[model samples]
Target: MAVPLLGEHLLFTLRSPRLPTHAGQVSFPGGVVEPGEGVVEAALREAEEEVGLKGVEPLGFLSPTYSPQGFLVQPVVVFREDLPPLKPNPEEVAEILLAPLGELLEVEPWSEVRLGRIVWHFPWRGVDIWGVTGNILKAFLEVWREGKSPPHELL
Candidate 1:
């Protein structure tokens, strides 16, 4: 998965309700790696395909993330200083969201027990970010919690 950061905001996609899985839910842009493509390549490609994002530079990679559905997803960080116009692919994306990274980092997510496991929900605006996407964001925040800088060259 590619987490596109524009300055201090993170880019997210609202999945189209017509989709089969995770429909109408918010998540980062990502898809399966192609025949000879690497994780970073797949991430950038998926970002472009799903949200019309282009020319972003990869910043770093986080630990592999696994969804409750048992899919292994590699998370990659990408960034662009200036805000870029985003066009959502109507078939896959309903809307594009820009989340305030500072607010997300400052607020603690609420949690609940679900299926014998603790699930966290990060509230933003009027929406709740949970499930796989929530887990990914939570893990990413761990870096800051540990007082470790993210794999970045420059903002």
Candidate 2:
């Protein structure tokens, strides 16, 4: 997954409502890694394909995230000096959402119990960013708060 930083904000996507699965949900730009591809390479490729994001530099890797669907997601952190005009692929993405990193850190997260384990939600623009995406964001924020992990350049 590509957890992209456009300056001081993070980028997320609202999946198209027409999609069969995970439709209308918020997520990072990602997909299953292709055969022979490295995790970071797959993340960069997926970001470009789903969101028309190009030329962003990969900063580093975050810890692997586990999903309810039984697969581990290897997350790659990426950065851009300035956000470019983003074009969402209509078949997969509905809208692109940007959240300032500081704002996300300040908002408290609500939790759910149905997933057998606690799952969290961070509200933004009236949509709940929950499930794996939320988990990923939560982890990233924790690391950022510790003044480590994302590399000094992000600070």
lDDT of 2 by residue, 116-153 (tens): 75667999769899988988888888878887744434
TM-score for each of the candidates: 0.89, 0.92
Q: Which ten residues in a row have the lowest lDDT in candidate 1?
A: 146-155
**Over 4 Å off, model 1:** 113-118, 145-155
RMSD of 1: 2.3
- Estimate the lDDT of model 1: 0.83
RMSD of each: 2.3, 1.9
> What does candidate 1's lDDT look like per residue over 81-130, in tens digits?
76888899999999999987778898669877655555668989888888
TM-score leader: 2
